[model samples]
Target: MDNKEYKEYTAADFLNDPDFLLWCLDPDKREDLFWSEFPANHPETFAEFRKAIQTVGSVRLNNFTLEEGEKAELYDSIMSDYRALCSRRRLLRRRLFALAAAAVVAAGVVVPALLGVFRPPTETDASPARASEIRLISGRQSEHIASESASIECAPSGEVRINGRKIASAKPARMNRLVVPEGKRADITLSDGSRVWINSGSVFTFPAAFGEGERRVSIEGELYIDVTPDPERPFIVHNALFDTRVLGTSFDVNAYCDSNRPASVVLVHGAVEITTGDGEQVQLESNDMFSLKAGNYTVVKVDPSQYVSWKDGLFTFSSGTLERVIAQIAAYYRVEIVCDPDVRELCCSGKLVLFDDLSDTLDVLSDILPINCRIEQRPDGTRAVCVTARTN
Candidate 1:
């Protein structure tokens, strides 16, 4: 099916599609691409598409030739459960929105695709080449690191090494920038033993070693940091919009400058003081989530573990928006994902176990939400995934 026709498919439609069923049973790269791309293109039915895929996968119909009556019965049973689950979901959503709006305000896009019309190239159609790359810049020397992850370790001799190369000496201080692009992540331990876990699509810059009186690092995108206990010297996290200072604490900072996505600081433990560019300040104790968007800051109580779970490859979303979930998946997998504005606010609550394969994660997402996913390759050799509302 073409993108437009596929956009009209519902969960029942996908489940009844013979080609879709066979692809689910034994998929090739082409089939994989189509399925992965479907959810990104049709997020309104993204959750349902996932359910259909899962139902097909779980059913062992290929074992034997079934009679027409038997086939009908099996299909009926599956649909019954699917409908019940969807019903429960609708009810659950009502309860979740009441409680989660203040705590986990799900956030992220626009517009309609005219049938049979070719969309002229726009900014969104650009190749997602940066998704698969990571860049490191030290002084005037810049290099591309080819790995899914990067790590910096402090030697027993007080030397700071990145990916096993000693990047800094003991006495003096030097600044280094580490940019983990959309499809990768990194971990860095400073000379002072403070460790930072950088998420995908993030940029982190820190000094080689700690100097007297203070430690500071600036980041764009997302990071989970564990600041070593040093009562005399405080650690400060700097971003374009704000700065967070702490004595000895663990916190997560997500400050992506690409879009209006709010810069947020979620404290896992200890205490922090956040100061915005405009000098507005907010103090957060343990388990406080502070978000700043459009120069306004809001604080809410939340379970810090849910916010920082990405560091462990476990994504926990409690009534989170589909837009945010898709964005996280896109960054984690280094794929381009576009969601229709219509379905961006669809709330989903679930825990996803991430695998190295992007398709596997999408499958989990599809199973959790009524969404379809598909992959499309651009002329520039980069792949993009489009998500939209599934057709009735």
Candidate 2:
């Protein structure tokens, strides 16, 4: 069945699907991954899909028997509940607008207003500078670091230091945002003693001092973090796609919002619980890598060091495709890289130390592989790197 057809499925439709029955009866790893991630990809059908799963599980475990007449009645009941939920949501939306309107009248304000009640929560105010600079933003103040690579320290007292010099002092409850542009990186020590290595083209939003409950931070792009243990309060790393919760763990998260690449989390030590966009939860152990690509997800065991080595100025891979390797390099340097089709699938295994100079790194790469690299300047004032088969 076409995957898109599942979006419009009802509980009855799911219950009648042969593939769904197979998934419940004999679960395959690849099938399980697809089914588990289905609800996350199609959130509007989550309730119906969950109801179907529960019904199947109950019948299998409890040996529940239902006649055809009873089955029809159950499907009807499920549809009625779904309709009621939709109605309630519409009513709540109306009520919210009413409240907003009443507040505006009471304030004696006649201004036009656009209420974003249905908008998703995001760090919309934190805007990073250009790719050539690293910026730290707190409240109305923005500080730009002068170095290509930077060290940032956040004290428990809400004091921020950049490259060993005091930069800004924030309130305990205030939020601080750090932006690492392309071709640059930053190492940060949080107030809770946890350490985070921010990669190029990343934005990290965190509180100066964590509150009484959870130690939460949000990110866009990639990061390698070693969280400090606090049993009383869990640490949560939030992205647009999922949330990673851990008490104390070292993990690498590659969650760049690029459509061509998948978002992944690789655990180095300790354990973590991941909650996807549609509220599905997944648990991972040490060395477990969870990858979500195009709404489907898989969990696999891998050498965690291979994924986290970028923080150490190295690109470590084993039989990685040339196309994938070049993609990483392009993102790191914030340059456009195009690979000829013939050489794109070439496989190689080794380590490349990412040098500060792009030309130097390209030279090493050319020496290791049968490829030629050329840099060209575009009219838009950006550079592009083209890779092709070596003529030699």
Question: Model 2, 162-268: lDDT tens per residue?
Answer: 86679769998998889987766788999999999998778999999888899999888889999999999999999989999999999998887666667899999
> Please, what are the lDDT tens digits per residue for candidate 1 over residues 129-172?
34456666667766666645566675434466656556544433
Q: Which candidate tops TM-score? A: 2
lDDT, model 2: 0.74
User: What is the number of backbone collisions in each predicted candidate, taken in the order shown?
Assistant: 31, 0
lDDT of each: 0.66, 0.74
Q: Name the regions of candidate 1 deviating beyond 4 angstroms.
A: 1-131, 142-144, 155-158, 162-171, 331-336, 340-347, 355-357, 367-369, 379-383, 388-392
Q: What range of 10 consecutive residues in model 1 has the weakest lDDT sum?
A: 115-124
TM-score of each: 0.62, 0.66
